[model samples]
Target: MLKLTDMTLHYGHSQILNGISMEARQGEVTCVMGTNGVGKTSLMKAISGTHPRSGGKLELNGEQLGVLPAHRMAWKGVAYVPQGREIFPLLTVRENLETGFSCLPVSEHFVPDEVFDLFPVLKQMQNRRGGDLSGGQQQQLAIARALITKPNLLLLDEPTEGIQPNIIQQIGEVIRHLRTTSRMAIVLVEQYFDFAYDLADRLVVLRRGEVMIKGTRDNLTRDQVLQAVSV
Candidate 1:
């Protein structure tokens, strides 16, 4: 549902992404695997409109990005769960989720039940401050907040980072469930090969901001993916 063709991005004078090309299909997870500092996050930033692309094209369901800012992208069915799970430390969970309402009409400002079903802890901690939650809970809160927008393209960056093993398993299950139950396309950036391999229908590996390897699960093995991602 999302496609990036020869995409490139720059930070001031330093170019971070180099002709990166990949695609994420509806009802599937396209995991971007790479070592640290390989521009995986930069690629995501380019797609999500947080950092605009310097060159190439970004199209969602054949619709090219046309001068859309980050808020505008969120309004156009793109929801991003950033690497650090940037939840508002001071806001209550409910209030934090309400922030997503900025992009929605008044009639669609409420959180969906599916978010509670996906992470019950978020519902339970509705009135608690986001900063008080543990790392795993914070991750769940971040994902929950993103879902409040009802997006079609979900961009998740390093979801398993710093999360507990059990929470990681839960997150993986949630990702798989979303792929099967919802039509939303997912772009996952994960350094955890085992987790990404298990859930990824397609894998895209990056090195120095370039596509090093990419294919479907039926064509690539865990070892091959692992080797490609190794620094």
Candidate 2:
């Protein structure tokens, strides 16, 4: 559902992504893996329009897109759960979820029960301030808020980072359910090897801003990916 062709990005001449090309399909998880400083988050920013790409083409569904800003991208059905959760510390859980309404029509302003179903804890803590929640709870809140956008392409940058193991397993189950039930394309940037590999339908490994290996899980072995991303 999403395609990037020879995409490149930079921060005032210090290039981050170099001619990176990949595709993410509906009902599948495309996991982007790499070690630190390998431009994994930069790639997420470029696709989500948090940072504009310097060159290359971005296509959503089947339409070609230009260098649009984040809100515009959200309006086009791109929901980003950026690293660090980035929730409003002072806002209540419900309010933070409601913030997603900025991209939707007034007629569709109400939060759906399915969101609460996906993260049951969110329903219980709807009235609590975001800053009052635990790390795992906050991460659940972040993912839930992104789901509020009803995106066609979901970009999750390191959802497991800093999360406890049980919550990480919960998050994985949520991702699995999404892939099975919806046609949304999920592009996950993860450093947690086993979690990422187990969930990935396809893998794209990056090293120093370029794609080192890209293929289906069946075609690539665990050790092959491990070796590629390690170096």
Candidate 3:
């Protein structure tokens, strides 16, 4: 459902992504894996419009989305759960979820019951401030907040980073459910090899701002991919 052709990006004259081309299909997890400084998060920023591409094309559902900003992208069904979780420290859990209402119509302002079902802990701490939650809870809140936007294209950058093992497993299940149940086109940028490999239907390995390996999981083994990303 998402197509990127020759996608390029730069920061202050230094090119981060060069001639990158990839596609993410509905009901599949397209995991982007790489070593540090390989432009994984930079690619996510470009797709989510947090940073504009230097040159290239971004198309969603056959419609070319030419250099739109984050808010515009969100309206077009792109939800980004960035690397740091970025939840509001002072806001209550419910309030943070409600923050997504800015992208929705006024009639759809209420929080959906399924959100609480996905993270039952969030239901119990509806009034607790975001900063009070544990790291894992915060991560779940971040994903739930993104889901509140009802995105067709979900860009998740390193959801497993710094998360506890059990929570990481929960997050994996959530991602699996999202792809299978809703057919969302998920583009995940992950450094955790096992986590990415298990969930990825297709994998794209990037090195120095370019694709080094791109193929289905059945065609690539963990050792092969691990060797490529190992610096």
Candidate 4:
């Protein structure tokens, strides 16, 4: 449901992404894997409108997008779960989720039961301050907050980083369940090879800010993908 053609981005005078092309389809996890300094997070920023693209085209559900800003993109159904899990430290869990209401209509202000269903812990700790939660709980809260926007395109950047193993498994289960039930296009920017590989329906490997290899899981084995990313 998301397509980026020849997508390019720059930082000051330096180019971080060059002629990159990728797509994410509904009910599928499109994992973008690469080593550090390969522009993975920059690509997410471009897609989520946190940073504007330098050139190329971005299309969502067949509609071409111009240089839109973050709020506009969020309103257009792009929910970004950033790498750092940027939850509000002082806000209560419920309040943190309510923050998503900014881009949504007034009638849709309430958090859905499915959100708490997907994250039962969020329901139990709705009144707790965001900073008081553990890292994993905060990560779950970040994803739940994004879901509060009712997005069609979910951009998740490194959800597994620094998370405990059990919580990582829970996050993976949530991602899989979302792909199965919501049918939203998910772009997972991840470096954890096993996690990405197990969950990815398609894989795109980036090197030096460009696509090095990309194909469906059926055509690419774990070893092949591992080799591509390890370089």
Cα displacement (angstroms), candidate 3, residue 200, comes to 0.3
Model 2, residue 215: C-alpha shift (Å): 0.7
lDDT of 3 by residue, 1-231 (tens): 999999999999899999999999999999999999999999999999999999999999889989999999999999999999999989999999999999999999988998988899999999999999999999999999999998899999999889999999999999998988996899999999999999999999999999999888899998988888785
**lDDT for 172 (candidate 2):** 100
lDDT of 4 at 59: 96
Q: lDDT per model, in order?
A: 0.91, 0.97, 0.94, 0.96
Alpha-carbon TM-score of each model against the true structure: 0.97, 0.99, 0.98, 0.99
Q: Residue by residue across 73-175, what tens digits does model 1's lDDT show?
A: 9988999999999999999999998998887889998998888999999899999999999999999988888888888999999999999999998998889
Ranking by lDDT: 2, 4, 3, 1
Candidate 3: worst 10 consecutive residues by lDDT?
222-231
How many clashing residue pairs, candidate 1? 0
Which is the winner by lDDT between candidate 2 and candidate 4?
2
lDDT of 3 at 217: 89
For model 1, the run of ten residues with the poorest summed lDDT: 61-70
lDDT minimum window of 10 residues, candidate 4: 100-109
Comparing candidate 1 with candidate 3, which one achieves the higher lDDT? 3
Error of 3 at 90 (Å): 0.4
User: In model 3, which residue pairs have backbone atoms overlapping below 3 Å?
Assistant: none
